[model samples]
Target: MPKNSIQFQKSFSIPEFIQMYGTEMQCRERLFHLRWKNGYVCPDCGSKSYCELKSRPLYQ
Candidate 1:
């Protein structure tokens, strides 16, 4: 491997991961950001505006 090669490792613990994404909303938000790094954008209509369902991890 090259000197500049990157190393992959599991640095975070389960508790830490849960702390960051312990709830449905938290998990959804994290996934949203990962999928849309710039911001939230509608996949169906291509709109930037959206509303979250109160009882579920869904966007409308």
Candidate 2:
């Protein structure tokens, strides 16, 4: 292992991470954005139009 190789794994402290993503909605939005960089698309039919399920954390 190299000395600087581990630098790529650097991360924010616990407090800072919580301050940035402290809410359920914030975390969900972040995940959504990361998962769909070009906007939401249906994995089943290859459609871009879809709606979010109210009672669950899913897209339909």
Candidate 3:
């Protein structure tokens, strides 16, 4: 690894990580944002029109 490797950078402490993703809802929201930073986009048809399923943590 290089001296300034990205993995070696400590952006947040362990406590901070727990604080951000310490719950199911938190984790879900983070995943959603990471997946669709500019909003949801369909992988198949490349459509932005989609809906969230309340029965589970999923979007279709």
Candidate 4:
């Protein structure tokens, strides 16, 4: 190890991480893919389902 350097000798799980940070960028990417994976789209027909109240990390 060196100064100001970090290391990890293990693998990482993306799904586990998404569960941990759903409101994070990583989760947002997964959510976008998951939503479109099944070919589902929201036309924003006033249901407010696509509404994002803030600057979310994954909403384009």
Candidate 5:
């Protein structure tokens, strides 16, 4: 790390973060996975869901 460089620190609780920014489901999903870590079943419908979202960014 450089002395002149700055690093931003996260200053919010998990729940607060979810509420502050994120799609409705995004936060819940993240929390669900974090809590479970090992594995977790769907709360709404007892179905197994993927932990990660399938996405790819095209950088210029």
Candidate 6:
């Protein structure tokens, strides 16, 4: 049989994970990209212009 598809996935140790996503900013940036692979867009008006909210995790 062929190798399992999961075998091709990248593996990381705890230290590696921490190095890549240990900070809040890093986590947020990763999430933002994952959520919007094509960059951010306004949900209300479909505009690309937006201001990142400082008090909360949102775009306005």
TM-score of each: 0.56, 0.70, 0.65, 0.29, 0.33, 0.67
By lDDT, the better pick of 5 and 6 is 6
lDDT by residue for model 6 over 1-60, one digit each (tens)?
888889888899999988878999888888889998999888889998888788987789
> Weakest 10 consecutive residues, lDDT, candidate 3?
1-10
Candidate 4 lDDT, tens digit per residue, 1-60? 455434555646987765756576666667677777754356554232454456643332
Q: Give Cα-based local distance difference scores for all models.
A: 0.83, 0.86, 0.87, 0.57, 0.61, 0.87
> What number of backbone clashes does candidate 2 have, counting pairs of residues 3 or more apart or in separate chains?
0
Top-TM-score candidate index: 2
What overall lDDT, based on C-alpha atoms, would model 2 receive against the true structure? 0.86
User: If ranked by TM-score, best first, what sequence of candidates would result?
Assistant: 2, 6, 3, 1, 5, 4
Per-residue lDDT of 1-60 in model 3, one digit per residue for the tens?
358678678698889999999998898889889989998899999999988898986689
Clashing residue pairs in candidate 4 (N, C-alpha, C atoms within 3 angstroms): none
Model 4 lDDT vs. the true structure? 0.57
Stretches of candidate 5 above 4 Å error? 1-21, 41-60
Expressed as tens digits, the lDDT of each residue in 1-60 for candidate 2 is 567866777799999888768898888888889999999988889999988888987799
After superposing candidate 3, which stretches have Cα over 4 Å from the reference? 1-7, 53-57
Residues 4-33 of candidate 1: C-alpha lDDT, one tens digit per residue: 434554467999999879998798788889
